[model samples]
Target: MKAFLPPTSYEYVTVHKVQGDDVREASDVLAAEEPLEIRVGYGPVGQREHRTISITMRTPGHDFELVAGFLLTEGIIRSRADLQGVLYCPDVQKEEERENVVRAELSPAAALDLPRLERHFYTSSSCGVCGKTSIEAVHAAGCPRLPPGGVRVPASVIHQLPERQRAAQELFEQTGGLHAAALFSPTGELRLLREDVGRHNALDKAIGAALFQDLLPLHEAVLLVSGRASFELVQKAAVAGIPVMAAVGAPSSLAVSAARNFGLTLCGFVRQQRFNIYCHEWRIS
Candidate 1:
């Protein structure tokens, strides 16, 4: 069955077209970005409560997954078992507002430490804090260093992932304005792909899907990003236990450092049948 499309993922916008020296007014397809409020609800059924965890500007599809992935990577919720259920706020009076709010109800036994969450809880679509304090917080999260000898990929397989990811990007084909993150198995099978205007959101959606499918600790997989790798991307991948990350663009110095410190295989400039491995070269044969 053909699934229904969420209207918030894309929209038609009037834009000025420019070609060489000529310009014309036309309607263009654009990837949508909107704010989503993520809340955490916990406590016994009779005494449940909610707290707004974050408000992020994101491309709105797979929003539930986005919330889940964000919570997991942020160290707010550790595992699938910590989550009771996720839902759009049903009591919201406005339909638009309803879609913009997501509540993740944690298990009754779960304990949330507000102090821990307060350190680096806020982030925007374009930038994630890489301050010394934020880095310390990431260290406090206790994401284990990626173990050695988990997954290895052939150079041929690694080289082909970008093209495969590009082929699966249906939205980008139409809008030409979205970033993507893809998951590939050790054998180079494209497991999943997600798109968003923000690279981090796309990555979150992809990780959230894997988590929903009980695919955490994806040590046998490689993550491919359509854009440059930043510290936030590497950090998120580390949280998901993803051992390898490849990008069609460059890797920031911090990204390279994070990948190296966490023992993840990092690849960049993955084009023209060539790529640079910034760290953990043993993962690629």
Candidate 2:
């Protein structure tokens, strides 16, 4: 998986003189692929059997957190108790995909309104807006307000992030295709970073990493995206209890609205030593 997901930064390649002749090889970076499935189940009574709800194409790592994050953001599941376990599925059909994708099975007690998911998504990854069609739907998502306590982040801290984030991106620098997500403490020490070709995948990887490390209920940390923050990113961060969401690029209008609705601290255009805090300014120390 590490081979699939390299550091976000690029490396300098030194070409030998080769008797003054030019080299003929190209550095082609590969895209990462993995399996992610969402499942549900009943409690520890009776068969307590689980059921398969959804399966998604994804990169190979962070299978569990991706499940948890996906369920929370999709409004299917909430809290630690809502989940039984999100692990690699031994489902035999998985071999059919180009690569073996993992699945997350939930307890039988958990019910997923598939129509809710189906109505919003026509194709995978193409439909970024499902379950969030109307403003009323947004209201139903239940993040109507973000962190009640004032959280503040400093502009100086944001100005220095792009460089620091770049320093850790070994793969993106080499491949020129991956997006990155880095988690930093309030004081600004980077805790974890994940990179992938998809902006959403990058975030999924970061959240997955955090979950793998037992870093849940992440109210105290700040999440930084290498690119612009999107509505899905805001939704994911909000559900994960991430109070601050920052981006190196511009955020969509929906993202701003979602941030405000969820009481999330949304910041964008985080370069040139300047940034804009679109919502929850109190947290920008």
lDDT of each: 0.86, 0.68
Reference-based lDDT, residue 236, model 2 = 74
Give per-residue CA lDDT, model 1, range 186-278, as digits (tens).
888889888888898899988998899999989888999999999889989999999999999999888888888889999999999999999
Cα displacement (angstroms), candidate 2, residue 101, comes to: 3.1
Count the clashes in each prediction: 0, 33
lDDT of 2 by residue, 1-285 (tens): 132442312334534344456656444544455454556654555766555556666545555556666666666765555666665556556455422434554555666566766665322335565534543464565544554885566767777778878888767666677788888887777887877656776776677666656787688888889988878787778767799989999998878887887788899999888889998888887
Q: By TM-score, how accurate is candidate 1?
A: 0.91
After superposition, the stretches of candidate 2 with alpha carbons farther than 4 Å from their true spots are 1-23, 34-55, 94-99, 108-111, 120-135, 142-144
> Each prediction's TM-score against the native?
0.91, 0.77
User: Model 1: clashing residue pairs?
Assistant: none
Best by lDDT: 1
